[model samples]
Target: MNTDSTRRWLALGALAVAMLTIGLDMTVLTVALPTLAVDLNANNGALQWFSTSYTLALAAVMLPAGALGDRYGRKKILLAALVLFGVASLACAFAATAGQLIAARVVLGVAAAAMMPLSLAVLPVLFASPVERARATNIWITSTALGLPLGPILGGWLIDNFWWGSVFLINVPMVVLGAVAVAGLVPESRNPDLRPLDLPGTVLSVVGMLGVTYGFIRLGDEGWGNGLGWGALIAGAIVLMLFLGWQRRTAFPLIDLGLFASRGFRWGAVFAVLITFGLFGLFFTVPQYYQAVLGTDALGSGLRLLPMIGGLLVGSRLGDRLLPKLGARLMVAAGLVALALGLGLGALTSIGTEYWFTAVWIGLVGAGMGLGLPVSMAVAMDDLEVARAGMGSALLQALRQAAGTIAVALLGTVLATVYRSELGDLNVDPINDSVNSGVAVAKSTGEAGMLEHVQSAFVSGMGAMLWVCAAISAVAVALALWVLPRRSAAVGADEAVPAVFADVDAPESTHVG
Candidate 1:
């Protein structure tokens, strides 16, 4: 390979490392939640915030972050985001309270918001060949996918061997490496036509997302009788409607409504959101099931997730090879089928369910995610023009992040409601709060029946949540088959190639300097 080719690939590696950090932070908190609940004296609401705060911030800031990258320089914005990510990770490590950690996670989310879009934007800038770009994109997607499952595994081991804070500390070295490599290897690129930042749209999106997410979380904790939850949910929905109206009228919109015009972008985005909804639900519940229900340590909880990772790797490999032949529609549909099957099996989980059974269903879920997510993203991305890459990718990321935030909130509500119902008027606040607390109460009271009841209630709640996820996946499968394009656009002389693979055969001069 030539020197330029080597550098370009190396640059992609650095970007992937940065992407991995963002993905790791997404689910790393799942295994840590049980620990945080005890160490930080956090309640169920606080536990939900620990995850949503980060994702909410990501959804809120991503659009502006993309605009910033486009108006400024992608490499410079990316480097700054990387440095801030490292700093935020440090803050998360030493947080003295749950509130502090939640705040730190918000900062980390903002930094990641910048990193996610800008790093993707750099791909078109680096690789001019269509085939090479497709290959590079797959590698990039795999790195991020790997981090989701790996987060629990790595965080669990760290929490077990060292401290709960070690999970956050682990990101420091990776951030440093990504930052140094990015600074040295990546070239700067920006849009010459400055896109005005939509301050009103940004504020509206942030507030609306927070309000809706908090409402769902509040409802979960306080139940349906709480007026605050209902009020917040209604108000949030109204505000989001207003935000959409504003976007349509505004000269400089935070989200480009026009992008939805493309059939590929619209349906690709829908499938992506559905997949994330199920994926986050799994990550949120499984760790607690492993630790609190099955009585495993954090490390053991993480290790148990390995089957899912294996299935994901296998599915991703197959998807990459088959996507060209099967086309986005069939490829995505196949993945959703696997996902629904896995979730359907998972819905049958009981307190006495065997580990092997759990592994089989969980692995299937992973495979389904692996097969669907990348193709969905690629199809959406394929619709973006080179000039709109930053904003377009950010728009997609925002949607996915927003869906994740809502998923955790909604699924958590489902889990808590089912758990409380199964327990049947416990009258004990600690026991009703969460399975972790219920377990603590059972242990303290030395009641074997109480322990059994707590486990049974939690398992029932998990099963209910999985059923909801499976239904969503099934719906997604039908929609994907109906909506996505049947085949990739042909690449031929005198024909316009898909934007993702456009200029693949172009000269090196086509790349941004």
Candidate 2:
């Protein structure tokens, strides 16, 4: 390979590292939450805030961060985000109160917002060849996937061996390494043709997304009828409608809604949401099942999730290879079918279900996800002109984050409602609130039957949630067939052209610093 080719691949490795760290951060906090509650003397509300703050902050900043990267330089924004993430990680490690930790988490979220979009946007610039880009995309997807499983294991280990704060501290060295590698390897790239920033559109988009996302999260935490949740949800919806109207009329819109004109881009974004929607539902329900029903510790629960991760890895490899021959429509449709089947099987889970049975179905879910999500992402990215890569990717990511938040909230509500109904006037508010609390109450009362009943109730709720997931996957299958391209010829013809990515067709900037 030529020297330039080698450098690009090396740059990809650095970028992948950034993706891994960011992905790990997303899920790692879950395993640490219970521990943080005890250590920080945090109330239940504070515990929830620790997670929600990060998510809300991340959602709020995605579009603006992407625009900034496009206007200034992606590599520069990414490097700065890394430093900020590292510093925030340190701040989290030393935080003395629940409020302080939540604040630190918000900062971490902002840093991640900057990193996430630009990281994906940089890929087309580095791997101009479609074949190479697909391979790189698989690695990129895998790196991020690795973190989801690894976070629980890593966080569980640290919490077991040291203070809860160790979990946040662990990110410090990794971020430092990623920052240095990115600085040395990744090339700075941006859109020269970008219009001046649209301040009004920016405010509307940020507030609109933040409000909608915050409402969903609040719905999960406080319930659907919560005044704050309903208020924010309505306000967000109205503002978002206004944002859309503004985008159409603005001189320099934050996002060019015209990108959605491409059927592939629109459908690809839909597929992205559907894939994560299923996965997030599992992520929300499974660990509690392990710890509350199966009587496992956090470490054991993390280990149990390994099969799902393993299946995802295998499926991703298959999807990467199959996508070229099968095309977007058939491959993605088949994937949604597999995903639905997996979730359908999972929906049958009962308290008496065997671990092997659970593993098999969950693994299928993982495989479907592996097969589906990355290819959908590639489909979306394929439509992007390099000049618009950051904005396009940001829109996709924002949609995905919003989808996940909504899916989890919806599923959480299902679980909560069913669990409460199944508990049936136990008159113990504590027992009615959560499975863990139910378990604790059972143990405190020395009622093995009560524990049994609680486990059965929780499993029933989980089954209901899984059925919801199956329904979603079924819908995704229909959408895939309806919206995705039916023939490879539609996209393959332009796969290798340098001009397919704008920067590759343009002269390199001699002034790149």
Task: Give lDDT: candidate 2, residue 61.
Answer: 75
Per-residue lDDT for 1-513 in model 2, tens only? 233877887778877777777777777777665456456765334545666567666766767777788789988998999999999999999999988998999999889878777777777777778789777766666566567778888877887788878888888887887888788877778878675878888788778866776676566556567999889888998998999999999887877799898777788888878888787778767877887777777777778888887877677677666777888788778878888999999889888788898899989988887777666766777776766555566667667766765666567767766776687756266676567767777999998999989888889888998998899889889888887776444344223221111100111111111
lDDT tens readout by residue for model 1, 1-513: 233988999999998888888778877788998899888878777888898898888888876886787888888888999999999999999999989998999999899877876787788778878888877876776577567668888898899899899999989999899999988888888878786889999988988998899899999999978899988988898889999999999998888788888777788788888888887788888988898878898988888998987887678777767777888888789989999999999999888888999999999998887778767777776776766544555677678879989998999999988889999856368888888888888999999999989889989999999999999889888888887888655322112112111100111111132
Instruction: Give the Cα-based TM-score of candidate 2 against the true structure.
Output: 0.84
Where is model 2 poorest over a 10-residue stretch in terms of lDDT?
Answer: 498-507
Query: On a 0 to 100 scale, what is the lDDT of residue 110 in model 1?
Result: 93
lDDT of each: 0.81, 0.73
- TM-scores of the models, in the order given: 0.89, 0.84
* Residue 232 alpha-carbon offset, candidate 1, angstroms: 1.6
Record all residue pairs in model 2 with backbone atoms less than 3 Å apart, i.e. clashing.
none
Residue 106 miss distance in model 2 (angstroms): 2.5
Off by over 4 Å in 2: 1-16, 33-52, 94-100, 119-142, 180-191, 382-390, 427-429, 489-513
